[model samples]
Target: MIEGPMGAKPEELDELCELVGKVFNWQMRENFPTLFCNDNTDNLRIIKEDGKIVSHFGFVIRDMIINGCRISVGNVGAVCTDENYRKKGYAWKILDQAIEKYRADGVDMFLVSGSRSLYIQHGCTHVGKVKNYAIYRGMPIPSAKVKAIKYTVDDLPVWSALYRNEPIRFHRPYNDFLVLTTSGLVYRPDSRLFSISDGNKIVAYVVGSCDNNKKSFGLHEYAGSRKAIIASIPQWFEELNVDRCVVPVNLYDIEFNQIFHSLGIEPDYGTTGGTIVIINFPQMCERLLPLFEEKIGSHIANVLTFSERDGNYVIGLDGDEAIISDPHDLARIIFGDPPILEAPTKIPAEGKLLDVIKAIFPIPRPEYGLSYI
Candidate 1:
């Protein structure tokens, strides 16, 4: 198989897209190229067999300061395998190559919009969970003196200033900000910043895109006061012309549930957002240890255990005398089905599997609407 970046000729891309469409049973959109080759061109990888495209995966390598230290990470996406070549191990081969390339390129961490199983096999650990929150059309929004408007280019400088001042937990390039605001997806009512002003200061603003056929709006970003956020909900809904709005929710927050309940909105479904596997243990520990030391204190000496099998990772955490596995595995025990622990193992009296799950897979509360590769 031939492995390389977007330097492939135009005819090569068309052939690849055609193969992807045939395999996935969906039309590969014309916009797929922009998704892969835009700003982050270095991390893209394509697999070709005998001069014909077989599988494709896209990724972005970015460096971010986490807890005061710069850490390099690879964000993966746009994964697809040609259907005619199924059961031939095309995906595994491509991923194997990609992971090696990422390591060679000096990425210490990897994250993707997939399940724990996908990255686990690649020596990655499940460090977090991402859940989608939805507000139905009938939900009652609390009254507040907040306002919102569609985003515009003139507002970019101000928005960029605000974003840089209080950066979101996740990483995003400035160009992505421009793309989301200008593309038909995210909307702002006026040329100037469409925002709610608390007297003179902007309080809360909603940034998102809509899927017309599904009548659903996906929120990419939100900022400002809680009161402003609640007050602007109705306008945000009407602007998108959608019956429901969805945003990612962190599992740790009780406030999210309270807000949804108070608004008379019930979530339609909650799916796994992304899978994480710890590749460089010491590096990851070095980066995140201080945060744990300061926030959770030193009650538990954290040690993570991970295994690779079946093209997925099976992650387990050991602390003191306790052992824990999958986050959903723990959730099933507490909420619905029996726990999926493999055998009798030591666990903390108060340390539910969910706690370990949360520790390994900490979900970031905010949503990233920009489809960056």
Candidate 2:
């Protein structure tokens, strides 16, 4: 067996691609290429045997500003393993190496869009759920007054500016921003690139792209006053002329949910949601302290113990004034299932205390967005 970092040879990438295609029963369009090439992010690892790659994973290094502090994060993607190598632990080995790399790179948290069970084994916890909502093409316009217009290429700057101001969390850089603006309509191919104008000034806007089939639209991010966003929806729908339009939902955002509800639309499919593992508890706690302080209006204390057993977690929460001996037990009461918790004992505590801890250390289950690896 051989294991190493990818090199500069194109032929090696070709072989790796063949291995992935065969294992996954998919075809490679142009062979394989170094994932790090031309991409600003550098979180990739590969496993090989006899110069033939057997498994691989990729990550992108990102920095998120939380409470005025920038936290380094690793977003995982491109997980694939050769079929013949299955059950031989090649995938586990590559993931272990990736974890070590993430630690060395000073990442405080890691995010992924894959099997929650597999990730939990690596100390990741369920953070949030992701939802995709789509409106089929030719579906009668749901009664909302908005204009749809074609977008051109001159609206990049406005789109980027709008994206930077939105409150949504982003997992990558915004350099690949592109904008298509025409007449009074705009299309953002990349999240950061957008379109805007206030009656004439720059009051409202929308940001998204057409689907791979070119017959539908996917809205990854959007910001502006509620009215502005509402008004632009129909315009976007008309411009795309596709069978469907999709957007992600942040379930915690009540206002966002309310807006969607008022529109008389709902999501089509459901999935487990997004996952985040807190690798550095202290760092994450410190970063979230201010938010907690603001929400609770008092100092907070808690002891969180996380253990891994048989690819699952055994968590214990103890605070100065309260105790939650087993998170799994608590899960049964709250979510009906211990989720991925390994222990089943429940701890009794004041409902207020439970609420406070939940607010601060929210297990985010985010709706999946339009963008995927």
Candidate 3:
């Protein structure tokens, strides 16, 4: 018999954790304390078969600030089904219910950690454009002018302060920051945090990981002065003795892109590390109205109307409008399509509609470093 597409009660978490650990082969409770803890019990949606936990889908609700406007994000992860339960659609059922539940709770979007066909079929997409840059050994980058030191637990206050300066970022509560950093669950198991200081005043920080062979570094998340960060890279490379360094710059980060461009280093285009689904497209766009007005002017933004009917989305401006039948295509345009991916042909390539989209879209998304589920 089947039971539940319901929230896990506190009593069921032990079994839930065990099921997730067996499926993913990691300690869910330990690695993702923010999501798996009792505080998030209701968010850990699950299915049961004759009193045994068989499927689970978990998420953490986060509020993001994009150009000072609040955009709610549901970070989905820890999803799995018992081996015998595969192909039964339990995962899909739980996912569907979770989305409906959170959408009502004001989750504007969902950032899923995986890119399975299940997500794609459900309107999730690889959106937003990012540029990947790499620095090889002896690449002639500037010498380090700032002092770099390994991050310490005591430095959380300073680190939090620095992170808050980002124009687009997660509104990480201090406790969540503390738990995530100490949990050692950054995207890479070998991830390390470094604080960059210019003469005793902290100017920047970076969280990076080295490959298994320790020959390359992946800069996952960085904050504060871009110049200071770039200056300290060579020092990090030399100290870690890694031959190469990788930095992913979001398209909205013009200053960082320009700095790398000035150095004659062209980057490869890519997507941010996960699939995203706009849970409530109209609400999300409404929240971004300030940003829309700022970029394309109040006249155009005020005249724009967003609507959806029968799963097809419409974005309009006065007389000209673009109707997107596929939600995935809509996600690409709303989030900014990577050139490597298909563009929204449904929208005019050139016109007032395109101009308005080109000016405002590809909203800057925060790199999920410590916030990763």
Candidate 4:
């Protein structure tokens, strides 16, 4: 009795959660309330056999800002298959269906929470660049004139305001924001939210958790002033009483990176936030027009176009064009690849075209943080 690579109906929700909990050993409805709710049945793709759902793949759609431009992104997670059904291609089939369904629904990209072979073979790549740095306690870095206080329900307005200031971030509606901060338990263990304040005014906030086994504090998400964010680290270290604090710095965050460099801390460059698949490159380029204008001029940004010929990408400005032979390389060009790569994709343009591509490209990739699906 094998049937369906189809959408999960509302009635199948409890069964779906049972399968998810059986696989992951935790209730999906509890950890990811936003995604596994009764209303989200349509987004859950599944395969049923022997009178039960044996395989599942789900995604939640949300709009995210990249340098002020909003683009639809599908946050894919909770993918699972019954142990008896592994290697039968059910997961792959469901993934293909999900992509097709979402693309037609106008989703520009997908951000999977896992970098498994299933995602890699489906054109999802780990091209978003970041640097991981460990700052040990008693480091010479000076603490700022700020106090770090645990976040409370009363601070929701200011918290949302500070998060909105992030140039590249999720378009989290108030309800979603509240749900994520309060209920998103998938974000490591014992995670806590703290607001950094200068006297009475809140300047920044961080959401992270301590790993008792690693004996370290991890800074997962932060917003507001980069300087304030950096200055508040030492205070966190002191409060947590950890020997080390692990910080992931986005490659495009120059000021934050510079501050770390000033402290003489070397970074280990790596790919973060799982793999990504660019479903509609043309739509991505179209939606990013504002970011392009901000980088170059509107005169040049307005003329840019993106298209796919065969399996390669064609990026054009005015009448000049550059062909990207590999989709992975094209993604790296648009976002970023690790700095340590022996061979990274080069802009295949010359003169003004090259300059424009360099100035605007490799835009900051949005960190999942609390928005991790």
Candidate number of the best TM-score: 3
lDDT of 2 at 200: 50
Residues 1-373 of candidate 3: C-alpha lDDT, one tens digit per residue: 8987998998888999999999999877888889988888998999999889999989899898988999999999999999988899999998888889998998999999989998888889887768999978777776556978888888788889999999988999999988878864664668888989898788889998998999999888889888888888888777999988899898878899999998889998777878898889899999999999998889889888888878778788767777778778778877777566643435644587877877887677777878888
Q: By the lDDT metric, which is better: model 1 or model 2?
A: 1
In candidate 2, clashing pairs total 29
Better of 1 and 3 by lDDT: 3
- Give the number of the best model, judged by lDDT: 3
Query: Deviation in angstroms for 322 in model 4?
Result: 2.4
State the lDDT of candidate 2 residue by residue for 129-225, as single tens digits.
Answer: 4455565554444343443333335455555565466554443343433301222122223332234444454544555677567766666556555
Candidate 2 has what TM-score? 0.66
TM-score of each: 0.65, 0.66, 0.95, 0.92
lDDT of 1: 0.53
Instruction: Give the lDDT ranking, best first.
Output: 3, 4, 1, 2
Model 1 lDDT tens row, 1-373: 5544333454455565566566655543333334444444445466666667677776766654443445566667667767665676666776787767676667766667665455556544333334466777877677776567655576676666555543334455677666656652332222123555655666555565566464786665655554676667677667656787676554544666567667665554443344444444345445655554554445542444334444333444453223334433322322222122344322233454346534433323223334333
The Cα local distance difference test for each model comes to 0.53, 0.50, 0.85, 0.83
Off by over 4 Å in 3: 342-345, 348-351
Lowest summed lDDT across 10 adjacent residues in model 3 is found at 341-350
